[model samples]
Every structure is written in C-alpha cells, then in structure tokens.
Target: MIDQANKLREMIRKKAETEKKTKHQIKVYSIVSGKGGVGKTNFSVNLAIKFQQMGKRVLILDADIGMSNANILMGIETPRTLLDLLKDDLILKDIIAKGPYKVDLISGGADLFYLEKLDDKKQHEILSNLAELDEYDILIIDNGAGISKQSLTFTILADEIILVTTPEPTALTDAYRVLKAVSTYELKNKIKVVINQVPDMDTGDYAYNKLFKTSEQFLKIDLEKLGYIFSDIRVNKAIMEQLPITIINPNALASTNISQIAEAILGDKEYNYNVSNLKQFKNKLIRLFG
Candidate 1:
C-alpha cells in the first residue's frame, strides 16, 4: 500500500509539472518612441499579430491616452474602451475587441488619462480587473509618443520595452532621451530597439549601432536590436485600408522584418515562465501611484 501510494503521488507531481509548463503567462511589452510618426503604433499592432501567428494569444492595449488610435491600424473600433470600464464599471471582457488575426484589443481612448488621478479604490479595482485577464500570452501596450508621467508608468511596468525610432538625427536624439527617462526608474525590463522606415540595410545598421552604443556607454545599459523595418510603401497602403501590413502583404519587406523580430524576441523562451507578470506590474503601479 505504501509503494502504491508513492507511485500515485509521483504521477500527480509529474502531471502538475506538465500543466505548469503548458500554462500561458502573460508578458507585457510597452512599445514607445521618442517622438511621433516613427510607426510605433504600426509596429505594435503588427507585432502582436506576429506573436498571434506563432500560436500565442496576444492582445494590443492602445494606451496612447488622448491619441489612442491603434484600432485604426487594426481596422476595428471599440465602442467600449478602457474608459467605459473605469466610468461604467464594465468588466474587461466586455471592453475587449477582436482585431486582425483575432488578437484581442483594449482601446484606452482618452479615458486612460484618468489614470493619473485614480483614487485608491479605483486603482485597486482597475488592477484587480486586469489581473483577471490571464488568458493572453502577451500584452503589447502602444504608448503615446514622447514621455509623460502616465506613459512612463506603463513603460516602467512592462516586462520589456521596444523603443522605435527612425534614422533621422532628431529621431535618434529623441530615442536616446526615452532611454534616459526609462533609466531613472532603475528598470530591469529588457530594452530593445526597432529602427523603422530605414531606406536600406546600411541605414538600419547605422541607427541600431548608434543607439546601442550610446545607451551602453552613457546609460550603462545594453539595448538589443530586435530588428528593423524597411521603408516599404506597403506599410502605408495597409494603414489606409485599416489592415495590418503582415496580413495585407505577408511578402512585403516590412512584414518579413517584423516576423524576424518576433522570432528574435521569442528566442529566449527557454526560460521559466513568469506567471506573476501581470500581478507584479499591477502591484508596482498601485504601490507607486496608489
């Protein structure tokens, strides 16, 4: 009887381990830029699609506050947004909209601005609601251009941050500034760079090397080159039609680059799953602001 009980317990333990391994742990990635018009929203929307294509459940959180427009790129509209959740006390599931590739979306609209003035009770309520969403494998938060208190909060709380910038000198300067601002938080999240709208491979290489070396030398932090998007006309064409470039033209250079970026990002999946990512992010947000 003792030996039989031991064998049964071993089987139960193995089953539990397998279940844990297969369970999805949500990873929050904040996609930000130093200035506007660097294709940050476009990257966020399409990158979420790429992750979804890899068989992971992905959600795009358009946390751009007053400039929330990721839905425009996804070709969907959310009648109910994060604002409705805060104001109407609606559950998160009700506010979520299905976008391209069937990825989930939560449009923050202008209502996200209220995050600054959230009372303790409201903060807890919001965090609690967010914690309830464990079905997603990834959450890509498309933050507004330029740094603000609200945007900074989201950036600091993410599991990783992708700083998008162009090859222009001004864009590089702004990207460096974004890195500087993030460094103030003594952040642990991995910071990656995506050189968007580059005219050629040389331009992309120059941009990445500039940003990478600058961050490493001055900020004392290393930045990863996630990948770069070519200056492809298909990107704009897809934007006009309200479709992700990946779906509109998977063969497009921009689409292919994004796929490579997704693969690079997922290359480190051998690590143990972090099941408490959302909870930890929530706690930090509340503790710091609540």
Candidate 2:
C-alpha cells in the first residue's frame, strides 16, 4: 500500500508538470445576434477560417442549440455533436470535425433540451472539459438568438463577445437588447459590434453609431466597432458550397472585409491571436489521446 501511494504521488506530480508546461492558447469568443438570418453563422465560420489562415489553431463551437447551422455553412456532415459529448460519454477528440482552412468544428445539435436541467456535476464536468481544450488558439462559440440563458452564460464566460447585426431596425433593437442583457454582468469591456450585410461603409457606420450611442447613454456599455461585411451574393454561394468565402472567393469584397475585421480583432492585445503556444498544447493532446 505504501508503494502504491508513492506511485500515485509521482503520477500527480507528472500531471502537474505537464499542465504547467502546457501554455494557455484558448480564447473563447461568443458570436451572437439580436435576430435570426443576420449572417451570424457565416461571420463566425469565416472568422474561424481567417484565424486559421493567420496560422492559429481554431475550434468553432456551434452553440446555437436546436438550430445549429455551422455544419451547413461549412458544407460538412457531422456524425457526432456536442450532444454526443454531453450524453454518450464520448471524448472531446471523437466529436470534433475538421472543416475548411483546417478549422476544428463541433456541432450543437438538437438535443439541447437538457441544458436547463444540467446539474452541478454535469456543469462542472463540461467546464472542466472546456478548460482542458488548451490545444485551440481560439474557441468561437456561435450562440443562438433572443437572449436565452445558454447564450447569456456563453457570452458572460467568453473572453470576448461579438454582437452581429444588420441595418434593419428590428435587428438593431435585438442587438441593443443583447447588449443590455450582457451589460448586467458588467462585461461591457469585452463587447464588440460587427455590422453585417450592409450596403456600404456609410450605412454600416450609421448602424454602429446608433447602437454605440444607445448603449452608452442607456446601458452604460462602452461598445467598440470591430468593422463591417458588405452585403455580397458570393456569401450565399459559398454557403451553398459548404465552404467559407475566404476559401471559395478570397478576393470577394465581403471576404476582404472579413479579413480586415479579423486583423482589427487581433490588433487588440486582449484577443491574443498568436499561435506560438498552440503547438505545445497540440503535442500534449496528442500524447494524452494517443
């Protein structure tokens, strides 16, 4: 028994050493919309691909609950999903799929009814697994619309919250609602806006300025403008092909705009797009899973 105890202590020490050597590379960014059909999923997919292009290891989590569309946008068929991870006792590596630009994708399938009933044990396990995903340079959580508890929780926990909206009044109202809800957590510093599907820069600026003023005056939220993507038909074509616009048509206006937005995001010291430590985490994961 004494020998066994000594072995266990050595094992614990080795594990601690591995974790200490494992650099932190994961940055969770939750992309949410005020309304549906605002191209939120498209933006999320392209942003993930852009990060991958910049040589960062990225994992895109489709956190949209019952109506996940990341798989559709990426044009890949996911055999397993977040449901399998939560329900079937499956490992993280088994459920993650590879997409365009080498982006890792995980689908949030229709089995999200259990989210509300999650017990402390399940919540703890989920968060533990999430923290262990140090292999990813960034984890993008594409959340569902209309201020659900899951969406709010994701936004609150994320290192950054990207609110996407169009020039439509309804979309703007919904964006404000989400901003206000997130402000309740005092996370205004982490919030940023992306005006999608706008006709031009002037219109996008108008929409962003309106939200910025309202958030400052009413919600006391200091929102930053990340940039905008134009309303381009090529986005729809790329979605139909199950490819990111950056891969399908990199020279398209929307694609160029998306890349610029990505650059702006990386410019922020808080976002941390550097990939020097991703290789270390990947090596650790390979060892642990092998």
Candidate 3:
C-alpha cells in the first residue's frame, strides 16, 4: 500500500510539472441556454469565428455532450473529440481539429455519458489536460441546454457565461429560471444575455425588457445585453451548407450582431483583455482550479 501511494504521488507531481511548462491563461467562455433550439450552437460557433478573425487563437469545445452540434454546424469532420481525450491519456493539443477562421474545434462526442461516472484519477486527468490548454486566447464551451448539474458546472467554471434566448414568452421564462438558479449561486453578475431571432430592435428591446425587469425586481441581477441577432434566412442557408454566417455573409445582420458581441467581449474593461496582464490572468485561473 505504501509503495502504491508513493507511485501515485510521483505521477501527480509529474502531471503538475507538465502543466506548469505550458503555463498560459485560457479565457473560458461558456454559451448556454435554459432550453434548446434557441440557436445556442450557432451563436457559439460564430462568436468563436469572429474572435479568430480578430487575430485571437480560439478553441471551441462542443460541450453539448449527447447532442453535440458545433462540428455539424461548422461542417467539419473531426477524427477525435473530447470523449477521446477523457477516455485516453491524450493531451488537449492532440485532439483539437482546425475549423473555420483557423479556430480549433473539439467535439464533446455522444459518448460523454461515461464522463459522469469517471473515477477521481480520470477526472483529475481530464482537468489537468484542460488546464494545459492555456495556449488558447479563449476557450469557448458550447454547453448543453437546460439546468443540469453538468451544464451548471460548466457555466460556473467559465470566466463568462452568455445566455441565448428568443423573444418568445416560453424562452424568456426559461431564461429567467436559469438566471434565478445562477443568482442562487451568486453568479448573476458574470452572466450576459443575447437576444436571438428577433424581428427588429423594438421587438428585441421588448423581449429584453421582460427579462431585464424581472431580474431587477426578483433576482436583483443587472444583466448585460451582449447584443441581439436579427432573424435572417441566410443563417439557415449557411447552416445547411455547414458554413458560418461570418464566412458566407459577413455583412449579414446576424453576422454583424455576433461580431459586435465579440468586440464587446474583447473590449470589456472588466475582463482585462490587455496583453500586459496575460501572465497574471493565467496565474489567476491556475489558482482558481489548483
């Protein structure tokens, strides 16, 4: 028993040393929703593409688990996925596939059901590999919809959480429930809302008002409006072709809206996107998950 324990300690030390060598800070942003089919996957892919266009090394992790679709929307065939990394001893760099705008993509393949049952050693391995992805300027996690413990963990673990919803009443109600749950954990401040599929700015504002007012009154959370994506048929056409709207129609309204979101996220003073503090930011994340 003593020999086994000593061996485990040495293995853990080696893993830690390997992680320190790649010391970098990855801005983890998780795009999630209360319900599905609100264009969550589309938003995540486009945002990552837009960021890449802005000269950032981006990695998009499809965290939708059972219903992963980022790769399908982007129209890329991935040989390996997050599942492969979790199931094997592969490093993050080994599994990442290149996507549009040179973005790195990792699919959270359908076999993630096994992830929930992973033992402590496996869990530590996964986290250690993720921690080594510090080479990326940003790691966008497109999480599964609804309020599962798994999804919530992703949201809370991210540096920022963007909630996507349509203007429909049901969508608004579901988003509110998500915000409320986030508030219970004091995560309301880190949350941002993006209104998708709106008819016009007036309708978008109308939808935002419903969520804005309720959050102000009930949850006391000031939700930031990350911007709105206008309804566009071109989006559907682009998706059918497995292309990002930014690539197919960069001038389109939806693409423009998503670009603005990328700018806002990059320019936000609170996020400290400056190059000077990149090392500091990385250290903070290390301390966070250490």
Candidate 4:
C-alpha cells in the first residue's frame, strides 16, 4: 500500500508540472505612438488578427480615449463598448465583438468618463474579471496619440510596448521624446520600435537605424527593432473603404510585413513571461495606481 501511494504521488507531481508549463496568462501589449496618423491603430487591428492566425486567442482593446476608432478601420460596429461591461456588469465574453478571423475586439467609448470615474478598487475589479475569462492568450491596447497619464498607465502595466513611427524627422523626434518620458517607469524597459509607412526597404532600414542609434546613444536604452511596414496603396484603399488591408489585399506589401512582424513577435516560446493570474492582475493594478 505504501509503495502504491508513493507512485501515485510522483504521478500527481509530474502532472501538476506539465499543467503549469502549458498554462499561459494573457500577455498584454500596449501599442502607442508619439503622434497620430502614423498607422498605429491600423497596425494594432491587423496584428491582433495575425496572432489569432497563430492559433492564439487575441483581443484588441480600443483604448484611444477621445480618438478611439479601431472599429472604423476594421469596418466593425458594436452597440456595446468596454464601459458597458463595467457599468452593466457584463461578462468579458459578452462585451467582446466578433472581429476578423478568430480575434475579438472591445469597442471603446466615445468619452472616458466611466474610465476616469474608476478608482483603484473599481479598476482592479474590472481587470480581475477580465483575467478570469482566460479566453484570450493576448491583449493589445491601441492608445491615443502623444503621451498622457492614461496612456502611460497602460504602457507601465504592459508586458511589452511597441512604439510606431514614420521616416519623417519630426515623427522620429516625437517618438524619441515619448521614449525618454516612458524610460522613467521601472517596468517599461521592454520597448520596441516599428517603422511604418516606409516607401522601400532602404527607407525602412534608415528609419529603424536612426531611431535605434539615437535611442542607444542618447536615451541610453537598447530599443529593439520589431519590424517595418512598407507604405502600400492597398493600405490606403482599405482604410478609405473602412476595411483591414490584410483582409482586402492579402498579398499586399503591407500585409506581408504584418505577417512577418507577427512571426517575429512569436519567435520564441521558450522564455516564460510573468503569468499574472486574475487576482494578481487586480492587485498589481491597485498597487501601481494606488
């Protein structure tokens, strides 16, 4: 009887280890830019789809506050936004609007009144509920232009941040300023750069190298180059028609770049990132904001 019990105990321990290894928490990524019109929202919408393509459940949060318009780019309209979930006590699954492919989206409210009214406790409650859903493997938040306290909060809480910029000098300068500001936060060190709307590979390389070199030399932070997107006519056409470029023109240059970026983001499955549970996510939110 004693030997049989020992064998069962070993089997249970191994099963627990295997289960823990397979369990992955929802990875939160905040997509931000120094200014608008840099294709930030469009990138966020498509990237979420790419993650879904990789067999991972993805959620896109249109947290752009006053300028939130991700649904417009994806040609999606929802009667309910995230505020409705918090106010009406709706489940996360119910608030999620069906998005492209396997991805889901959380519509943004016109105004941030409900978000602003949320105290630390209230915010924690919402996040705890969100984490409990476990229906998504990742959450991508598309923030508004420039830097604000609200955007900063999202960046600080994120596991990774992708700052999009263009080849223009002014845009790069503004991106550097944003980078400098965000560097003060202790947990925001894993920031990456994405040069968007480039006309060619040369332009893309120049934009990325300039930002990477400047960030290293001046900001004293090693900003990794995530990937670059070529400016394609298909992208403009899709945006004008309120459609995602990838859905409209799968073979377009921009679409190919999106796929590559997604692959690069998922390059390694070895490193175990912090898997914050629902309660831990709530506690961290309260602690960070409190």
- TM-scores for candidates 1 onward, in order: 0.86, 0.84, 0.84, 0.85
Model 4: lowest-lDDT 10 consecutive positions: 270-279
Model 3 CA deviation exceeding 4 Å by range: 1-23, 86-89, 111-113, 273-290
Model 2, C-alpha of 228: deviation from truth (Å): 1.1
Candidate 4 per-residue lDDT, tens place, 88-205, comes to 6687677788875667778665634365567767665666555554667788989988888768888766777889999998898888888887875554765778999998889989
Candidates' lDDT values, in order? 0.82, 0.79, 0.80, 0.78
lDDT tens digits, residue span 1-290, model 2: 99999999999999986666466656778899999989998999999999888878899988898888888888777888655766667767878887756898887676543534567666545544544676677889899987887788665556678899999999999999999888887654547889999998899989999998888788867788999899999988888777889999999999999999999988777655523253443443233222
Predict model 2's lDDT versus the native: 0.79
Tens-digit per-residue lDDT, 1-290, candidate 3: 99999999999999987656555556778788989989999999999999999988898888787788788888887788655776556887888887756988887677544555667667556556655665678888898998876677766567778999999999999999999988887754757899999999999999998999889888856789999999999999999898999999999989999999999988899775522124444354344333
TM-score of predicted structure 2: 0.84
**What does candidate 1's lDDT look like per residue over 1-290, in tens digits?**
99999999999999986565345367878899999999999999899888999988988888888788888888777888765667765888988997757798998778766755778778677766766656787888899998887678876667778899999999999988888888867664358889999999998899889888888777856687888899999899999999899999999999999999999888767323533455565576676556
Query: After superposing candidate 1, which stretches have Cα over 4 Å from the reference?
Result: 1-24, 86-89, 269-275
Off by over 4 Å in 2: 1-13, 21-23, 86-89, 112-126, 185-187, 273-290
Better of 1 and 2 by lDDT: 1
- Of the two candidates 1 and 4, the one with more favorable lDDT, higher being better, is 1
lDDT, residue 166, model 2: 98
lDDT of 4 at 123: 66
Candidate 3 TM-score, true structure as reference: 0.84
